[model samples]
Target: MRAADWSTPRLGLSELPVIEVPNHALAFGWSSKSGPIRRRVDDCPVASRDGPVRRQRARWAEDRRSDDAIATLIVPIEVGIGLRRRPIDDVNAWLDTDVATHLEG
Candidate 1:
């Protein structure tokens, strides 16, 4: 994650890393400050060059009874993926929200 000051907290964890997970990583575990958390990811579809990436994780809650176990989707802001230019506030906002959202899932 990029370093930031006390002004903006939402953009503090942006541009963390460009990890390339293996195709076989169906269930992955990572350690956090609290404890270890395991995530089972079914699919990660890249949105069009227009919204954010659709990162979905599997839900293991007891109330989840649907055939699909996918959790809520989180759209992360990612730079250095498309055309490069001066990244002003407007550009960063667009890239984070409206840049890529048309790819076929």
Candidate 2:
């Protein structure tokens, strides 16, 4: 199947992170090709002053059906790269100094 078919709305990436999937989930150990593959994307939550509403008020019925159909059944694999140090600290430090004069105001 084409990667586009598996594209998840919540996930911005163009391709599925299949590499992150665990081998144990596969019927066989690990093979370049083989075994069942599934993909899904959930609805984005609505954040408002009212405080974290679980349901979307607009097109509620239609959205529920679409959300349910999308979440039917699928195995997922999470893949991420670990950083030796947090990047945010360095970024904040840099921006806090002369580099980001706009924020000083």
| Clash counts for the predictions, in order | 5, 0
CA lDDT, every model vs. true structure: 0.29, 0.30
RMSD (CA, Å), candidate 2 to true, equals 18.1
lDDT of 1 by residue, 55-88 (tens): 2222322113244432222323454453223223
Residue pairs with backbone atoms closer than 3 Å in model 2 (clashes) = none
lDDT of 2 by residue, 1-105 (tens): 533333322233354333233444323334322222212223322111111122332234245437653212111222353221333334334445553443334
Q: Which ranges of candidate 2 are over 4 A from the true structure?
A: 1-79, 82-85
Lowest lDDT block of 10, candidate 1: 30-39
Displacement of residue 35 (Cα, Å) in model 1 is 17
C-alpha TM-scores of all predictions = 0.18, 0.19
**Model 2 per-residue lDDT at 87:** 33
